[model samples]
Target chain A: MQYPEAIAKLIESYSKLPGIGRKSATRLAFYTLGMSDDDVKNFARSLSASKSDLTFCRICGFITSKDDDPCVICSDESRDQSKIFVVENSQDEMAIENTHDYHGLYHVLNGVLSPMEGRGPEDINITSLITRLSDHSEVKEVIIGLDASTEGEATTLYLARLIRPSGIKVTRLARGLSVGTNVDYADQLTLTQAVNGRTEI
Target chain B: MQYPEAIAKLIESYSKLPGIGRKSATRLAFYTLGMSDDDVKNFARSLSASKSDLTFCRICGFITSKDDDPCVICSDESRDQSKIFVVENSQDEMAIENTHDYHGLYHVLNGVLSPMEGRGPEDINITSLITRLSDHSEVKEVIIGLDASTEGEATTLYLARLIRPSGIKVTRLARGLSVGTNVDYADQLTLTQAVNGRTEI
Candidate 1:
């Protein structure tokens, strides 16, 4: 039988999310029905509150509470202002931060250049990064830490061309075989990068 | 850096879902952040509406809009009242209905007996089913269409014992190897069931 209107609507809403298909959406909607009233309210409230309550950092374009405009990273005095890591999104920034090797600040591009999808440099937060760089001469290095995709390469090239004229050093995350990955399973591109980026023993 | 309160809240909420992990939850939260304001509002509205605007069918214990108290299936005159198919939840009922073979009514048990999880016959909608059966007197066959889990078996046995005393024919879904499944790959229990439930060609 067809789901009731409310359940169907919720399923539709869930299916619109990334990585969630119609079947998973239906499962999720049914799971929601089993949730307590308070939990359901909290879940719904969080969905709306996350969008309406948070503000983007003015400098880094990272998400932050409305009261903290530049976000914790941008506002913190301990973070190295001399280097800025440019990433595709806040999740990427978080991933880099989790590594604990980089103490530099971050610039969230929000998305990469996907011309096929009508996503140009203007579509993302590139302008903010450019403005931040131009306004602050202290940022000596701009590290492009994007995904290993066509859009990422295009965005990196675009950013390099734009930032190179300003005398700022531009770099990218090393594209090599990832940790715990078997050499036999490594793709040709990764193998090539691993050989190209061979470090001294 | 720590996620903003709103983003963190959303991720936590998403992670609470059955199949979603922390990484998937984070991805979903980011996707939510990228959603248009109207879309986000609608999503949140749908979540709340699905919880608040839906009610359980009084007769069958199935989910339905608040206005449709007995639900479509329970109220429909075309359904064969002589047979009541018992399922663990609304999703199971939907799955059975999708097959299109069952023209009888349904009785949602809401959940199966799981002593480990503190769920007993008293915890679910079994009492309502029993009440419906006794009051109606038309339900001749009670089909238990629960999952092939230990909990499902226990519930089915319990239900069979309860209904047999009332002189009602209690049946279960035929358990065997699934269609198109290779016999070699089938589990031992499934193989056993397949052998036991063998039919004459």
Candidate 2:
């Protein structure tokens, strides 16, 4: 009782996506079948267009249109170029930018150093970041805004060791219990950081 | 601080799918971008191809390729043409086929009677089913294999009322508590059906 070849192929394609299992994929395939021909074309086109039409920003590694190589953040003159926030990827950059508190430009590393996963310093987009820092003497500080994971910590230390020798101030995102998280439920590492990094009210 | 237009479009498309929300869509969009160009093209091709290449079986309403008008079940000479299992959609038809117990042909109603949703008798693929029964005097029994919803009950009653006058037998799936379900935890309706439909071993 196998499904038709088209349905089976579409289900397999959908199942490749994160968080989608075979059952969910089947549901998606059936739903796609119900869509109008125009909608189906647009849906399929978007999958390919999202990948082909976008490219990494040459200067910052943030994703942008193929025509915008330096990206909007790097080209904007009003942003504080002196404070460069180095994040793990474009999504992290977006999350930070959404806060609207940091008016500094960003540098996306594309990925963190994961030695266990065979991802090392060379695997990520680090060379361009170093070159950007050396080229812009106005950039006085490098803020490592990576996740609070082992790989993020390793990447932060690795970048700090490299950038600090050039007389540039190096810092990292403040580690503490997240806002809206109950103190009782906070993990041990976060609680310890919150205690150690206590500031005046 | 918007995601690139292509990325945003892909995310929107993923979000439109059932069971996927904004967070899941974002994750899927990023995963799609990470896929190889050939894989992405294949994935997109499957979406459009599944929609355009497959169509409804003209006789049974089951989804099939364009060339298979009557579908595999309807055209099979070995199957019992005298008994027809009426289901809501192709998914149900597949589910029933998976059991490997029934050898009768199927008639897909496309949808059940959902008057609350403004769906009437004409809204679903019922006309063709009635025409098939009228055209084939060999179909002596009609088995309603719809879901156990109020709409399913209404549709079963409606179909039985129409086909019973033709001197054909009309039956529905047995109603009772499912196997392995805890009797203590069963809902009132199921418990009631279990009591009413109780049988001796």
Candidate 3:
């Protein structure tokens, strides 16, 4: 059956997102149609605004709204800069931040090492992380806070092999986190447990 | 955690939809940020286009992109004007059309009768439906194709009580369809059974 071109277009856009199927997309489109004109305008405006407003912090690679070189995490004096926890993405950054247990700063890798997905050490911010380590001798420990996936494991191994010779302590989040679970999906208690039970590599 | 105003706005817009939680909205906002400029433009365009391009058919209340006074269903020579099935929304029209079992026309109520929500016969297209019936003397049977919900039951009773006085046969889709299931969610076989086994109201 044919739908209005506008409705069809809206449904198509909604379906483009991850996990949203055609039926769900159509429902969303109809829901939007029922909304007021102001709401629809706000929805459209936000779609473009998110891309233009948010920026990756230059110092720590964490996503932040500020245009300053150092994000809130990097600039905060109370946080422990000596212990840097490296994560796979910004979502993990939020997860860890929610626990209020991690007083250390974060370095987002953007993605894990995955040869199958054509992702490698060079493709990520590994070189920059190494440079940061060399430049900042005060950093005592480097915690690999990546997920428990195959790529997370490979990246941990690669990072450990590179930093072990530097005489800096390299650690990883504990195995308390279940296999196949992404760091973003983990609950606060599980993430806290993993952080507290970290093991030296 | 402070997000950029634009990102926050985007997340808020996504949270307005049904079933989408804060986390899902954030994920969607990030995904939208990663989309290409053309895709973003297309999405925005689709929203406005659907709203502006489609018009509700005056005769049947079905939304159509056509500029014609009566929509395809109302104007089609092949369709049996004598048999009209009334539905609550346009999606139900699609569900019935998918089966291709009925060559009859449709009448959309825009919504079901719900006194609790302050919706009455006048709030929907009930008046227009009455006008259509009075104007079309050739019409033989009127089928109420509403869901088995409280509002649907109310609308059916209201319509049955009103239309029975006109001396024309009034019928409803059969009891084969399970209660609380929307017509759009019903399978083809179940919908077919409901349509074929229709009884006098």
Candidate 4:
């Protein structure tokens, strides 16, 4: 009445991921059974290699190969060193980098400061940002590109207040109604932020 | 702008499974990076072991560990060998077993006949079922437990016709309005089936 031991173990592991529940995990495990042997081997190898072959950049906290310490963004001297676009994760850094709009370097905070979850400033990569900033006097501005949630807002404020005393410029990513989003359908918070942060053309 | 090579490979592997898109894959891959070394190792080991440590039951076509051929259900002699529950996958077999309502053995077809998709009798486990039926005179009846979809219905009817000639009784799972479902909200097809299959209470 139970799944075979190997299958049950795989299902349990798959369910450990975010958003994947018991049903989804079961479905995924069965699907894996149907996959070609080569694909399964590759998938298994990739899972192992991700842990063995990858490490976080010490300065920026971005993911990189184990051999590379500072990551490509940090090692590149051609990029702007004066501004550090801080985000919650490397995925956000990639999203910004994909746009080809910002020429500055990035700093990954790994997570937001959520007091509701007992995640304080010390829990995330905030102190490293301060250290990186103080160590490099050339770094002029810190862009607090955190989420628009309450936690993000609070973290941005905390970082801004902490950095401004150093006489270095501190700002946050602008909040507004998203592009292509209908004004009538936009949430109250989004509309309020758009109105409050209105700019002249 | 792309993810680090190892991370990208892991994300690609994650997205290969059902229902996981690029964004979800990226999130899962990053989460894997955050998991402990031991947990990641276990996940990788499970993935490899699923393929290496398991095999299909030769008789029932259900998943079982490599050393066990006919699976637990087929090998059990105390269960009712007079009836067989036929299903499309091992997951379906597990679902029926979880209900604890049916004590009969199960036969997994692995897939249903889909003529629209060019799948015919030869593609699925139909021939094996026929062989098993003729091999065992004790199997007096076969209960078709496939899904209510078009392919399932087709396979059920096809198999019923194929085995009924040999004087073997073939029955199908009932089709009616599900328990606790709002009848008024049920679709027209379901209503029609419910009306057609009504039994005097």
TM-score of chain B of each: 0.94, 0.95, 0.84, 0.96
> Candidate 4 at A107: error in angstroms?
1.3
On a 0 to 1 DockQ scale, where is model 2? 0.74
Instruction: Pick out the ten consecutive residues of candidate 3 chain A with the lowest summed lDDT.
Output: A45-54
lDDT of each: 0.91, 0.90, 0.85, 0.92
The 10-residue segment with the lowest total lDDT in model 4 chain A: A170-179
**What local lDDT does model 4 show for residue A4?**
85
Q: Which wins on TM-score, candidate 2 or candidate 4?
A: 4
Model 3, runs deviating above 4 Å: A66-70, A75-79, A177-201, B66-70, B177-201
Best by lDDT: 4
Better of 2 and 4 by lDDT: 4
Please give the distance, in angstroms, between residue B120's alpha carbon in candidate 1 and its true position after superposition: 2.0
Residues B122-174, model 2: lDDT tens digits: 99989998999999999999999999988999999999999898999999999
lDDT of 4: 0.92
Rank all candidate structures by their DockQ, best first, as comma-separated numbers.
Answer: 4, 2, 1, 3
User: What fraction of native interface contacts is shared by candidate 3?
Assistant: 0.66
Compute each candidate's TM-score over C-alphas. Answer: 0.89, 0.93, 0.82, 0.97
Q: DockQ of each candidate's interface versus the true one?
A: 0.70, 0.74, 0.57, 0.84
Cα miss at A124, model 3 (Å)?
2.7
Per-residue lDDT tens digits of candidate 4, residues B61-131? 99999888879989999999999999999989998998999998889998999978999999888899999
Highest DockQ: give the candidate number: 4
